[model samples]
Target: MTILLWILIAVCFIASFVGLVYPIIPSAPLLIVGFLIYGFGFGFTELTISFWVIQSVFIILLFTLDYLVSSYTVDRRGGSRAAKIATTVGLIAGPFIIPGVGLLIFPFVFAILTEKIISKKTWNESMSIGIGTVLGILSSALLKGIAMLLMIVVFILYIV
Candidate 1:
């Protein structure tokens, strides 16, 4: 039973990592769920209060990082507030509306359209902002993937 539980936890962790590429997967929440499964299965003997707190902090930090890094990247590239907001909305909406392809297409399209419509920017300028948004999204995804991996490692170390 214990071995099976651990294997299940490992599968969840792998899914969380894959979530980095697939926006709909809900990676951070998946990580917490895995931890909870471990806690319930193993009785949480090694998962002290401090350990829980630390893991919670990491979860919060990584979640915030996902948004902040992308927004910061857009801002650094001179994207307006509306562009950033649109990028975020696109990211949230993409996976639901069109699944895998939407996740990749919506952010860029939304950012460019937002800039052109809301900011009254020329096509070239709007395209530039959209490109920045795409880059930011890619960078944030990479960072989130790394952070998720670290969180998994920490969870395993504490539980073991």
Candidate 2:
């Protein structure tokens, strides 16, 4: 049973990493969930209060930054709600469709075209949103990466 749970946790961690590329799955949240379950599911014998508090804060900050920074980036670049949704869908599809550069290139081109067609924006403004979507992805990833790093360091210091 312990071995099974450990395997499950590791699988969840892998899923979380994959989720980073596919927006609908929320990789960071899943990662934190795995950590939380690992910490609590076995009865919390090894967790210090400070460690829990630190992890809780890191998880909170991770999601918070991911959402705020990404959405704000889109909004700043003139992307509407529809643009975000379309970009997410495109991101998922692009990798399977074209592979490699398709992941980045497809989202950008799709976003630009969608904005131009749906929102009826000029080519220039539509292009701006494309750049913004990239910025949003980068910013959100950066913040999440930092939070995860902090959690890893804390976990090592406090538990392992």
> Which stretches of candidate 2 lie above 4 Å from their native place?
1-15, 24-26, 33-43, 99-102
| RMSD of model 1 against the true structure | 2.1
lDDT of each: 0.84, 0.76
Model 2 alpha-carbon miss at residue 106, Å: 3.2
lDDT of 1 by residue, 1-160 (tens): 9899888888888898778767768898888888888889988888889778887888888879887888787887678999988887898898778877676679899999998999999999898888888888888888888888888878778967
lDDT of 2 by residue, 1-160 (tens): 8887778777877776666665556776666676667776675666778777877787788778977987898898879888888877777787678765566777788789899999999999999999998888777776776677667666657656
Query: Least lDDT summed over 10 consecutive residues: which range in candidate 1?
Result: 95-104
Q: After superposition, how far is residue 42 of candidate 2 from its true place, in Å?
A: 6.9
Instruction: Give all TM-scores, in the order shown.
Output: 0.86, 0.76
Clashes per candidate (backbone, < 3 Å): 0, 0
